[model samples]
Target: MNQDRILLEETFYVLTKKNSVFRVRLTRKGLSLIKESDNQEKKQTIPTRDIIGCKCLRSRKSTTSCSCQSLPRGSLKVVEENSGEQDENDISAYLYIYAYILQNTKSGSCKRERTIITLRFRSFDKYEDNNKEAKRWRNTIKQLIKGEQAQNETPDTPIMHKINEQRKLLVLCNPKSGPGRGKAIFQDKVVPILQEAEIPYDLHITKHANYAREFVRTCNIYQWSGIVL
Candidate 1:
């Protein structure tokens, strides 16, 4: 337990930069023991299992009134673990974001079709160690890649059986996205599938901002299966 006096409200610096959600892990029994602003103990336990994902929120108390939940998933490595090492790592723990599902009943008119059951939940995370976080990310990527390949694979179609070479796709990338892995992710996770499916693609590196856009404006649209932005 690497305990640090981290203020939850001020931790959005790392959260916003990551383009990720925050989460926390606590069982029903644990939540019941939490003290509220009124100095009264919570009479009930909020289920931890109900959490999924959350949109980043500015305040945590607002969601508490509703069945919504939130958890912290990762942490940032701000300072060096030791002095004069000339290196530092981003340190964070895994957390889960959670919320509840609710249904709405309308007045008058008897229409079963109009009834709606919508999700009324938020998100948070389960705190985990740095090594654990790395392992979790790796496993998740592998699982997602495997699932996508399984879904895209087709055995019956003649086109699937044969290699496709007639089409060429050009990928234009932007580096501003969180983690800066947009292009690498496409190459590692997407390109292999394209190759297996026998689709031809050409990758053109953009030297400056808006380079791809300027190129697209003057080019013939019929020449490709649409230019990817």
Candidate 2:
């Protein structure tokens, strides 16, 4: 009895960087990317275990307005030419998926290669509406990733993907923590650990004394998932 259910599915055009169109779907197992052009269909599946992290980003601004017309199907050259031509009025949300896949090296060994899949979702009249959809997908993907990790760590642990907040971590770094080694400590020690754990954090360097304290006092703690000092 194969009981894998499709959680979410959407057909999106114009992958920002790659400029390819795809219909993406999510299941409990993995993400399926399906591309079809000129009656030829292709599919690539990224196992949930390979995906490290995913993030949703809002576009800055575009001078040229973007519209989905007859996309020159399978033509990379045309796609690249018009990729950056987006309208300032377009309120689009971008979703970035990070995964590591094995690649054959010239040295006759396999190496883990990081690939980022950027998805641009838009076409709605309202920005909020588009962002909401993007966030929904982000939340689902994040929870699935976390739930798998939790299961691996403890077989008997109860996994709750619904409760994990997709909030940025506020990191306060002291430049003088070790008289001069604070930067090194953060880069060499803290960063690698955070990356491996797949925690998204925003870094802030304290310049004057009590800077972090004063900032936290006035800043909204609700904006952050957690604070790290």
Give the winner by lDDT: 2
**Model 2 alpha-carbon miss at residue 99, Å:** 1.5
What is candidate 1's CA lDDT for residue 188? 80
Candidates in order, TM-scores: namely 0.27, 0.57
Residue-level lDDT of model 1, residues 75-163, one tens digit each, is 22222223343121213332222234233457644422111111111223322344244344333222222222112223441221221
Q: Which residue window of length 10 is worst by lDDT in model 2?
A: 73-82
Model 2: C-alpha RMSD to truth? 9.2
